[model samples]
Target: MSNYKFILSGGGTGGHIYPAISIANELKSRFPEAQFLFVGAKDRMEMEKVPEAGYEIKGLWISGIQRRLSLKNFVFPFKLIDSFLKAGKIVKQFKPTMVIGTGGYASAPLVKVASAKGVKCVIQEQNSYPGIANKFLAGKAEKIFVAYDGLERFFPKNKIIKTGNPVRQDILNVSANVEEALEYFQLNKNKKVLLVLGGSLGARAINKLIEKELNFFAENNIQVIWQCGKLYYEEYKKYENKNIKVLAFLNKMNLAYTAADVIISRAGAGTVSELCIVGKPVIFIPSPNVAEDHQTKNAKALSGRNAAVLVKEVSLDSRFEKEFKSIITSETRQKELSKNIKKLALPHATKHIVDEIEKILKTL
Candidate 1:
């Protein structure tokens, strides 16, 4: 059992990939002799990121179907068939004791093939609304780890386990790093800090909203740490100054969380989970472009509980400043938000997930 081999399949975005890495890392800490192999889509970030985390990864020629009809859509069936064959080969060769899918189209083929061949499958879903891949794989999954309630609508009631999303280890200790985090960001202690995140690739709508509000922020005496994303960096970098720190991406996310007094962010499930741990006052502007508007759902799950504020992208022009001003100007409001969000933090989520993984490992 100590020498068990595990296959983890998920990718497409940081939300999916990072959770897989976190789970694998926790499993490794517990069972040093365990073997792990990551399976991701070819040409995706996971191919680069997983290896950087000291794990071996294989890439399948797979991509999600494009909503609009195109040449890629026409070849979708071929890609699906190719992925199935390659995934079956990998499962046959690896002979993993268990396969875990963290929800991406790339994960479906591998998880499907492995389960069919009698390998146990586990699904970790990050969103309040499960993705097509996880939904399709639900019946076959032995256990479905989820962050939100009400997922029984999509998954089997008996199979669901309400373990929150696994967050970066750094996030669990962010409070201890505040002084160093402020120095790392080179910010003034006297001024309020507003941290803005548009996710890893960046969100066009968020960047535009930030750009339009630069003057407003300065007038309100708030300094900014804006992670505008790589795609939008060039356009937004010109706005950076002594008061405005614009980063294409944040390598030290824990530090960013530590330094901020208030946060404005996209509500990707992974980001929301980390934010809850950060426990700062937050204004969540979910990306409207994602699948099933799940980002909005992720945000509402918190805002509904009064843990964070949710503002739809469509209403940013009308409500952004009002929402931002309310949180920034009111100390009591900030404390209440921070306190409430912290109440929702599952600091031991990684351990809880691995505990479940251990239970399954025993069964195997």
Candidate 2:
């Protein structure tokens, strides 16, 4: 018999998927007899990533509600009804002792149905500004785990616990391993490396900015570990050359973090969590395309504390080089960011989050 069973929900983006995975992994590690079942939006990355990580997952027919007037909005009611029914089935079949959400489009249905059944429900929100689904689940959640402070504005203050975000354990455990990292990327140790990520799909503006500055990077004696992402890879593949490694997806992000001195990243919650552990100087280019401009909010939280830098997407054409140059060249500035941001690192975050889970389980 299993010691415990859990139903974990979150997806639609790496930010949500990763934190859920970290918690699941930690739970499994601590309680080897634990059974975990993940629920994510159908067709999202978690459907594949979770299984690969050695967990079972079920897909729900949930998708984000369209903000614009579109045909997609017509199906919202039906999808919600269908997803909630399916979530109820998953929970009943699994007989979960607890349910947890990391926050995404898929989280709402899972947490709502589980909590309605009187199971212990918890949500881990990995941002300063919580997403709609997490905010929706906040009141019902027995505990709300957050990475940023002052999030009581979104959730029930009495219920919130600041546990920080869970990052991959390997990243926290990894040291410079400069030689091994260089070999992983097949990069030269003599050159300074700049790692650029616009996330899994690539941001158009960051891609174009990099194209414009490609020659400049080569000229500046800098090398690049660029993850252009799948959607934009075809358009930018021709620019691939020596000293520039371009990937549609970076499977070895831990090495990418170790190899780079400066990071140009979209300030997604997951990216920010990883960066705090990586503790490199960063230039955040918040995608103006997100639901609430939360990326900028995340970046500002770091920069406001003198922990990082921000360059708005619209301002990138003019300011990318200048800001990047200033941060990379200043040893003093890099040291400060590294030290201050490391203050935000949740190195044992997975452990702490799982500890809370055990606390809830023990109360029963």
Candidate 3:
């Protein structure tokens, strides 16, 4: 049994947390006896999610700087210093062979301390535009795993590896289960299905868009599987009926992907990676609230290649139905989008990243 010790830090949103978990799982599969520890921001989603994934996690008192002036800004410096001291202690106690950061507020201090202590560090940048935390950590990282090309603009050219973003393994084989997926979601196989995703917490604009288009979906004989997200479920649950299935969150995304003839979603880096692997015709309404407006950049990458369609939030009220109808009504468009998106899938990203970690470990 190999006795490698690892410290993984990332979490604030599911985008960061899931990739950290996926990487940890890939590492555990290869080294069954390996020890893993996850570091994340206190009171954040990762504190709950990491333990649920069957790993121990430590929470750091860290948060991102608010874009606007607020009381939190004054507390930021103290939190940073406290987190750094705590991260240093954790590194000394854990004595990890390597540290991996997937990018979140907590990741900054942990990876910084680990690198300062002369530990190997690897960072995964999930977006075309790197976040502030990852951009700062890039110099100290031994290798930087990126999901997009042209990231040499942010990190050193020699350190960047185009490994792609890690996605849930269950989503990889969705194509083979179409019939099962239709039955699981209790939808008819004869009608076209549109799956709408807004991520785990949910997107308010997407939810409102669906609300506006409900009658249009019914009139056109289309079925909808809408994952409205946890925060909006109570408000939108009344819309659940024969033709519309409203879920707070989808635990079986494989089934949802298989049932979808077309997907309408926010263009998160992880979502983009999964959609490419699922090979579905997609209409991207990128969330405008994200850092550096990365979601728009992600959607544009595919739309520019004719792999997906993009609809900006500002034009949604005037153009959603027209843009959505264009895809759903055309069989040739669906096939073309699916074929092109599938060409972009990097199914072995987790395995390849682990291989890089192994290479670094071998040198030790």
| Winning candidate number (lDDT) | 3
lDDT for model 1 comes to 0.91
User: How high is each candidate's TM-score?
Assistant: 0.96, 0.94, 0.97
**How would you encode candidate 3's per-residue C-alpha lDDT over 1-364 as one tens digit per residue?**
3899999999898889999999999999999999999999999999999999999999999999999999999999999999999999999999999999999999999999999999999999999899988999999999999998899999999999999899988877665478898899889988999999988889999999999999999988899999999999999999998779999999989889889999999999999999999999999999999888999999999999999999999999888898788889999989999999999889889998999999998999
Error of 1 at 350 (Å): 1.6
* Clashing pairs counted in every model: 0, 0, 0
- Writing each residue's lDDT as its tens digit, candidate 2 over 1-364 gives 3488989999998899989998988888788998899999999999999999999999999998888999989998999999999999998989899999998988899999999999899999988888999989998999999889899788888888888888877788777588888888888898889999977888888888888898888878889988998999998888777788888998887888888888888898878988998888888889877878898999999999999888997787788888888877788988988898888887777788888888888889
User: Ranking under TM-score, best-scoring first?
Assistant: 3, 1, 2
**Model 3 TM-score relative to the real fold:** 0.97
Runs off by more than 4 Å, candidate 2: 183-188
lDDT, candidate 1, 210-239, per-residue tens: 899999999998889999989999888999
| Superposition error at 114 for model 1 (Å) | 0.9
lDDT of 2: 0.88
Q: What TM-score does model 1 achieve against the real structure?
A: 0.96
lDDT on C-alpha atoms for all candidate structures: 0.91, 0.88, 0.93
